[model samples]
Target: MSPDLRVIVYPPDAQGGRRVRVDGEILGRALGPNDLFEFLRQAAQDADDVCLDDGLLIEWRGGGPALGSPDAA
Candidate 1:
């Protein structure tokens, strides 16, 4: 967690898909098609648990192509 961390949220795309991006990096891309609702709920919980003063919580919503290899990011 960095003091200068930033959060950005991108709304789901036409296909109701979401991603998670932190700062300028893509954390994960393309959540499960059948689990979008559960995903969002869990994401909200996870984001809420994060200490805002510590780092940042970012959520990117959309069905666009995932940025990079999710595991290495």
Candidate 2:
């Protein structure tokens, strides 16, 4: 993982949306949960793990998206 690259997602707002932060910078309004993956992909980010607001962990391995770590419960 690149030290300059980190994703931070804030808890849901009144409309059940989240604000995504890439390296401590925000784009505009909050984004839907489904858009997270698309954002990362468009940004060319190849992450081993994606940490959500509720602590749900999504991982990318071998260029595919998975819900969680393969070694965890």
Candidate 3:
């Protein structure tokens, strides 16, 4: 993961599902632990943060410098 590029994994919902959203847009959905990890991994590649249900907040710490800017540098 890049320094400035953080990855967040929110807690699962009541039904045990997670969502990958950015700026109020739905990107994907993960329905299990494995799927959630995979989602987080993929999101990490782009250094993006994800929220499970637009509430919980979980993020990866101690990353290197961002490969690019958030606006696509």
Candidate 4:
């Protein structure tokens, strides 16, 4: 099986903590405890690429879809 690219956040001094959101939403926190494999599997199915706050990027296979023409900023 191929390797999955993703990051899992472990709580500090706590169990069943929040999971960080992959999208570009700062000050946002994930709700509920989740399994790493399951979360990445689902995210990979939807979005082709995922970015983290710490300058870490996890891209899916096939490089995902290409962006459209450069329209606006």
Best by lDDT: 2
Clash pairs for candidate 1: 10-61, 11-61
What tens-digit string does per-residue lDDT give for candidate 1 at 1-73?
3334444435554553445455565445443422322343444444334432222343333312232213211
Name the lDDT of candidate 3.
Answer: 0.40
List the global CA lDDT of all models.
Answer: 0.39, 0.46, 0.40, 0.32
Clashes of 3: 2
Worst 10 residues of 3 by lDDT: 64-73
Q: Is candidate 1 or candidate 2 better by lDDT?
A: 2
The Cα RMSD of model 1 versus the native structure comes to 10.4
**Top candidate, metric TM-score:** 2
Off-target runs (Cα >4 Å) in candidate 1 are 1-3, 30-48, 51-73
Per-residue lDDT of 9-57 in model 3, one digit per residue for the tens? 3445565445545334455655543454465565554214434232234
User: What is candidate 2's lDDT per residue for 1-73, written digit by digit as tens?
Assistant: 3445666655555554555566656643334434675566555665344443323332222222222223222
The TM-scores of all predictions, comma-separated, are 0.35, 0.50, 0.36, 0.28
**Ranked by lDDT, top first:** 2, 3, 1, 4
Task: Please identify which of the two predictions, 3 or 4, would achieve the higher lDDT against the true structure.
Answer: 3
Model 1 clashes, total count: 2
User: Candidate 4 regions off by >4 Å?
Assistant: 1-10, 16-18, 25-34, 45-73
Q: Which parts of model 2 are misplaced by more than 4 Å?
A: 1-4, 28-32, 46-73
